[model samples]
Structures are given as C-alpha cells and as structure tokens.
Target: MYSSLLMILGALVVGYMIPVKHPSALLTIRRLSSWMLYLILFLMGYGLAFIDNLSQNIIQLFSQSAVLVSLLLTFNLSALYFVGRYLAMPAAEPIHKKAITSLRCLKNLRCLSRC
Candidate 1:
C-alpha cells in the first residue's frame, strides 16, 4: 500500500512537471492512468476471488448465522455507496445539467452509429 502511494505521488509529480504542449507527456499520463486503473481492477478481482474463504471466516466469527451476515454486508455496502456519493463533491447543478445534456447527445450519436 505504501509503495502504491509512493508510485502515485511520483506519477503526480512527473505529470505536473511535464509540458502541456508536448504530445508525448499527455500520452504518458494517459497510459499511466490506464495502467493504474487496470492494476486496481486486478487487485479488486484478486480480493473478490477469496470471498468464499472470507465468508467462511465470517461465518465462524458470527456462529454460522447467514441472516445476520447478510444484513451486515448489506448495510456495509449501502454505507460505502452513500459515503462515496457524499464525498464525490459534485459540481454545481447547472454544470451537472450541462453534463447530462452532453451525455444524452453522446448516447444519441452512439445509437445513430449502431443503426
């Protein structure tokens, strides 16, 4: 985790130093961001792969009560999503309206392309 933090910090520093007019700099940032996204996804997949073992551990800790386990898990996930939305710090309402409009345009273009 510390290594990942250091790597992110390094990337941010390098990204800040790169000249905006240089095409290669922007490309490098894009590639780095994509790789970082893939790495995170892989890590999440790895963790998810062990869910069965984790569930067993939870059962042991909770005395094999599935209902209690399900409720706890549901609440945890709900809390996470709510907190994430709260922390998203969305732009003002008008900007969001504009974004929605642009997204609708993009969807229309996609539909047209498909047709």
Candidate 2:
C-alpha cells in the first residue's frame, strides 16, 4: 500500500514536471482522463452493487454521501471566498450588446426571425 502511494506521488510529480504545450495533445490527455474516471466510477458502482445487504443500507449510504458532499462543498466555498476576498480580484467587464439587424443576420447566416 505504501509503495503504491509512493509510486502514485512519483507519477504525479513526473506529470507535473512534463509540460504539454500542444492543444491537440492536451485535448487527447483530457479525453483519456475523463474516460478513465468514468471507468473507475463504473467499477466502484459495480462492486458496491454486489455487496450483501446493500438494499437495506441504501438510506444510510445516501445520507453519509450527502453529508460528505455537503461538508466538502462548504469547506471549498469558504476557502474560495476567503482567498478571493484577500486577492480582491477585479470584476469582469460587461459585454457590449448590439441590435440584431436583418442585414447583420444576412451577413452572419443566422436570422432570429423568418429569413
């Protein structure tokens, strides 16, 4: 277990050290990571489904999961709030809006009303 954890940390360090500059390579990495995460979650659910007395413990399991999610959200939000307050980040500029004229729509190949 310890060796496994050490190896995981080493991999993380190596991943951090390697810089991925290409957009296509980054996108491929992102897609692969997402699929891997989905597979892991599916396997976890599959394992849980085979556990004995799972039906009887469903409510307890849900409540525990809810509490855990709530705690994590609260902590994360509070931390972000404090850090943002300290940073005093500038507010985003409002987008400039223009009237959608028929001529503009013709040029853009999109018409809000009947073309």
Candidate 3:
C-alpha cells in the first residue's frame, strides 16, 4: 500500500513538473481518469456484492451506520441550537455596538473568507 501510494505521488510530482503545450490532451486525459475512477468504484461495488458474509450483515451494517449518522447529526444540531440561543440571548445593555471588538473581528473574518 505504501509503495502504491508513493508511486501515485511520484507520478503526480512528475506530471506537475512537466508542462503540457497542448492543454487539450491534458483535458482529455483528465476526463479519461475521471471515467476510470467511476469504473473502478463500480467494479469494486460489484465485487463486494459477491461477498457472502457482507451480504448477510449488510442490513445490520446499514442500520448501525444510519443510527450513528442520525445521532451525530442530532447532537451537532443540538449544540448549534444551544450555541445560537446563547449568542442571541439579550445581554446587559452596552452603551454601543462598538464596545464589542469580537463582532467587528468576526465581520472582518467573514469578509476575508468570502474573498
């Protein structure tokens, strides 16, 4: 696995160092690689379907995964809700909004992220 990964990274480094004069050929290769990836995934799925033990446990696996995912989403949303409520709660009235530097920093951060 390490050797394969090294080979792939080596290929990427070689490819990056080499400049292609005709971008059209590079575009074609990119499209071909995308299709090859889909084909590989399809074949992998098809192969896995033939495994007897996995077929038997598929339902249980799916159920466990679904429950885990739902719990994760629920907890995340609950935390988000609590955090939002805390943020929104009325605080001791400030003389002006200018008193909070954090709010202005967050606005600047938002602007930078968009850029």
Candidate 4:
C-alpha cells in the first residue's frame, strides 16, 4: 500500500510538470498516459485471472455473493425511490412534467442528429 501511494504521488508530480501549450509534448504525454492506463488494466486482469483459476468452489461462492449483493442494492434503491415519491406527493406532478418535457426535447434532438 505504501509503495502504491508513492507511485501515485510520483505520477501526479510528473503529470503536473508536463507542458500544456506544446502540441507534441501534450500528445506524447497523452499517449504515454494511455499506455500506463492499459498496463494497469492488464495487471489487474492478470491478478483476477489467477484468482479465477482457483478451485471451482471459491469462484462459485464469489459469484453467488456478488449476485445477492447486486439484487439487494437494486431492491433498496427501488424502495427508496418509491418512498421518496410518496413523501413528496405534492411535488411529483410538476417534477414528472418537467422530466417528460426534457426527455422529449432530448429525443427530438437525437432524431434530428443535432448532437
């Protein structure tokens, strides 16, 4: 953890030192940053792959736990939305109308390919 923190601090310092006005310097930094991101992603994938290649029982347990947690989160959010709507019963109509108009405008813009 300390080493990771140090690495992050070093990256921040290096990133801060890069010039923004020079086009080639900016482009080179952007490319290098993207490569670093890809490398980090690859390392994470490699670690997860090792965990996945472990015994089937461990993998199954993790999968089941993940699904259960996701379902709980979904239900909790749905319940909260319903309760909030009920408590704010007077404001729902105006909010709903505003949301509908905004959505319609967004849809029309998409249809016209303006964005």
Which RMSD values do the candidates have, in order? 13.1, 8.0, 13.4, 11.2
In candidate 2, position 62 carries an lDDT of: 96
Query: Which pairs in model 4 have colliding backbones?
Result: none
1-115: candidate 3 lDDT, tens digit per residue = 5986798789879979988778899999899879977996898689778878996789997999999999999999999999998877677776763444665667787645434
Best TM-score goes to which candidate? 2
Candidate 4, number of clashes: 0
Error of 1 at 55 (Å): 2.6
Q: Over 4 Å off in model 3, which ranges?
A: 1-18, 57-115
Predicted structure with the largest lDDT when compared to the true one:
2
| Candidate 4: segments with Cα more than 4 A from true spot | 18-20, 52-115
Q: Give the TM-score of candidate 1.
A: 0.33
Error of 1 at 54 (Å): 2.3
Q: lDDT of candidate 3?
A: 0.82
**What is candidate 1's lDDT per residue for 51-96, written digit by digit as tens?**
7778667657567577788989999999999988887777766654
Q: Report lDDT (Cα) of residue 33, candidate 2.
A: 81
- The TM-score values for the models, in the order shown, are 0.33, 0.57, 0.37, 0.39
Q: How far is candidate 3 from the true structure (C-alpha RMSD, Å)?
A: 13.4
lDDT of each: 0.78, 0.87, 0.82, 0.79
- lDDT of candidate 4 over 1-115, digit per residue (tens): 5998799899899969865898898898889989998998998679767774467667786898999999999999999999998876564444543333656767687644433
What's the candidate order when arranged by decreasing TM-score?
2, 4, 3, 1
